[model samples]
Target: METKVIINEERCKSCSLCVSVCPKNVLRISNRLNPKGYHPAELFNNDECISCGFCYLICPDAAIVEVRRPIKVKS
Candidate 1:
């Protein structure tokens, strides 16, 4: 599955605000550290992501670069 939430690992500061605000718990702090020496946030469950943009809004550093929700089609 394609990731709806795109996070800039290098820009993340290990803040869990995005993780806390995520409704689906799709985002999590990665075990590996980034260039800045902080654990970056990563998309763990692409299928569960709802693309509500809560994570993006809560990220103070704007680590979440993009949020693309699937467009529903009318049947």
Candidate 2:
């Protein structure tokens, strides 16, 4: 299984809530500011993400979204 983290850069407030909640430590606050003048959260290393959706759940601004995709079986 694979998970994709989608962040709405403009909506992010750099609250760091998602970054702290993520168990896999996949998210981090970026140094660059977004159009909204906020340092949005970014995915640093998604390989460790378990599709836990903690980032999405913790984001108060609804900026984070997680998509889980099942890996195809090769028989």
* Best model number under lDDT: 1
TM-score of each: 0.90, 0.84
Q: Write the per-residue lDDT of candidate 2 for residues 1-75, one digit (tens) a residue.
A: 234787888899999999898888888999989998999999877677777788888889988855464576899
C-alpha lDDT of all candidate models, in order:
0.90, 0.82
lDDT of 1 by residue, 1-68 (tens): 67898888999999899999888888889999999999999999999888899998999998999999
RMSD of each: 1.4, 2.2
- Cα lDDT over the full model 2: 0.82
lDDT of model 1, residue 34: 94
Residue 8 in candidate 1, Cα distance off native in Å: 0.6
Model 1 segments beyond 4 Å from truth?
73-75
What is the lDDT, from 0 to 100, of the residue 52 in candidate 2? Answer: 79
